[model samples]
Target: MTNKAVLYRMVMDDHLCPYGLKSKDLLEREGYEVEDHHLTRRDEVDAFKAEHGVETTPQTFIDGRRIGGYDDLRAYFDKRVQDEDDTSYQPVIAIFSVAALMALSISWAAIGDLLTLRAFEWFVAISMCFLAVQKLQDLESFSTMFLNYDLLARRWVPYGKVYPFGEAAAGILMLSGSLVWLSAPIALFIGTVGAVSVFKAVYVDKRELKCACVGGNSNVPLGFVSLTENLMMMAMGIWMPIRQFVL
Candidate 1:
């Protein structure tokens, strides 16, 4: 037994007190030390926030990594909790987004032909509205992102807060691409963010290997190339700004 141990830091939330007690109990059961930081003062909270740079309450700092609030705490202690979303809804979400993208992206040309402004608008609408699936998950869905990277990509996977959070922000851009006016600006911005995400996933990630995004994409058959294919979509995204939403 090491004399110095890493403590699981549980910062209490008024709504999530059960989480704290559950964490404390689970830690004891697991033989890890637990430290409870029931923060009530703004100064104390600020100090903790400065150490971790997190804005939410009910945060957990485990071995210098912030485990985030309640949902995360539940995911940690209970396998059933985490698997609940993955086994249950990931496929459904994928199906919804896939169908929306395909139905719109395919029939889009029939609307006015690809080169025409109306047809172009339909593509943008498909992509943006289709991203509604993203709102189904938060930064937590890919909690396994880092772990899945190293084993599959064959390199060190970075564990950081920014990547998943960036995905959340990208969700907004996905929605923004629908508008006639804001579409151009938001499309450019979304593509740039996407490029950065790819760089991180490929060069910065372990082995530049692609992770399985969704099983069959409902019926879309998204294979290994699908990951690379999105990069091309990033290329296609450039056309979005071309029309420039002239009113």
Candidate 2:
């Protein structure tokens, strides 16, 4: 006997339900023949929800048993469900992974080598830009979280708000290998402050707090990863000037 599933999801003129598409795709992937039902109109959606006693669209059923929504379906399939407040390194991992790939690609294209000093430099610079972008997404939230652990931000509240922009500026300048005078100091100053703050917060105070490295809303723990970010910046800051004037 063939396994079968039923899925009801909204498909409106203005908006298509993403979870509905995911549900259909998942069912097919799991070797289930899906009986897909589209509730295209608002009234139809409402009626379907009322009839099934469900609160949301993209409802799924397997073997004549209600399987709830997308998250429920994932749980049914023994997949990890994402929780907003859960402490996860996924965001930082993704940023660093992409940055590494980008750096390697650039090195290959430019210098005909995958692993070069240039590649490492680019990796750090790109990672900085990506991390800064995350914080820039919601500056207010970032500043609020930053002030919790950053000594400078605590004393000077506006420093938290300005940090993302400063990081981005330093990253861009470093990437282009320009304005060593400006970029180097910016990177060094922020990196030094950040390293000290993270060390004090996590080591000295032994406070358990979230890292604002990825973003304010990130669940990444405030510890080694955060310290590494600052250390990388400090390294880049010191290296760039020497590489330019000395080597």
Candidate 3:
């Protein structure tokens, strides 16, 4: 009779207890009609699904293309996102990986010119350590987003499981090199690992995520400079072998 209006399968955070209610409260505040599954009767929901062919939940459809769930919904809040079913994504972390490497490279020469070689070594090593930790944080964000919750998070593959450990290993090595008089074998191995780590992460992984690596409130695509930076980092990793022998 009335076009049988409907919406389904959106966010399921158990009242946002794990992270905070801010996400839910903010969504609600935005005039989005949210339906928490825990609040509804199971039988009624099943029946509604059967009646309306409701195949997806926490699903936000602006003019019809399914935008997945909470995360997608948030993404949609940005006008640039055209519609749901849109999966072309880039993460800031990707860009950061590149930028970080470039900074290290340029700083390598500048720090050398300005300070003692030993001092510059410390700066590079410590900078990588911090960046590695930053990558780990991004990993955590990916973990939360990829978990089987109320909607799309379940559909897309989880990525951090493939990358964080390697990055962490790199950080540990670089930090070690920075901190003390380590063997060339160890220093070279770690540096190589860091470089290879970023490359594997960038090219091997599928581009399904929002790239939360940008390290702030902004969400932007990982640019070409970022890609070039990763390549350079990969080279640096290779250079570690030489550095270990020489420096």
Candidate 4:
């Protein structure tokens, strides 16, 4: 006799409980026979809820033992579920990865080569523009969060409000291959301030905080990604001027 698990889920005309499907799949994958129960109508769902005193659908039962919800079932099987509030590098990784690919694609299309110094400059510029877009989406929220650790922003709150605009302007100017005199200095000053702020907040003070690099709602840490963003700006700032004037 196979070990049997029961899954109660909604499969109504307009609704199908995703957790219920997941519960059934998990049980079958774990070598258990699944007895799937669908509450296909409102009254049936209501009765099921009343009988179990549960407020939601997709309740699971294993060998007559109840496992609460999707998260609970995962816990019962010693599996880990990502929490909503957990800090993750996923957002930053996704942004940089896509930006790098875009830079390569654009460089290849424009100049007929993927491997060139100009491509690197485009990569940095595109990255700045992308990050600036995030901040610009919610300037009020971004500035509020940015003031927490940015040295210049903390001293002069107006700077935090202007940071995203400056970033966008520099990036756009660099991308157009014009106005290096203006873009380079702006990038350098902001990048220098940002680098010092991140170093102080994360390394010197040993403080744990979220980075505003991607916006106010970001979960990226106030360390490596933040520092890298600043360093990229600084390198682009110094390189653009030299390339235009000397190289």
**Candidate of highest lDDT:** 2
- Candidate 3 structure lDDT: 0.43
TM-score of each: 0.33, 0.92, 0.36, 0.85
Clash tally, candidates in order = 0, 0, 9, 0
Models, CA RMSD each? 14.9, 1.8, 11.6, 2.7
Tens digit of per-residue lDDT, candidate 1, span 1-247: 6211233233435434566566666556656666666765667667877877776556765676766765675576564455332333445356445645554555554553335444434443444444433322533443344344323223323422333333334334433444424434444444454445555556665344323333212222223333442453455456655645432
Q: How good is model 2 by TM-score? A: 0.92
At residue 153, candidate 2 shows an lDDT of 97
The CA lDDT at 192 in model 4 is 95
Off by over 4 Å in 2: none
lDDT of 4 at 49: 91
What's model 3's TM-score?
0.36
Q: Each candidate's lDDT (Cα)?
A: 0.46, 0.94, 0.43, 0.91
Clashes of 3: 9
Candidate 1 clash figure, as a count: 0
Pairs clashing in candidate 4?
Answer: none
- Measured with C-alpha atoms, the lDDT of residue 216 in candidate 2 is 84
| Candidate 1 TM-score over all chains jointly | 0.33
Candidate 2 lDDT for residue 170: 94
Candidate 2 residue pairs in backbone clash: none
Per-residue CA lDDT of model 2 for 132-194, tens digit only, reads 999999999999999999999999999999999999999999888899889999999999999
Error of 3 at 52 (Å): 1.7
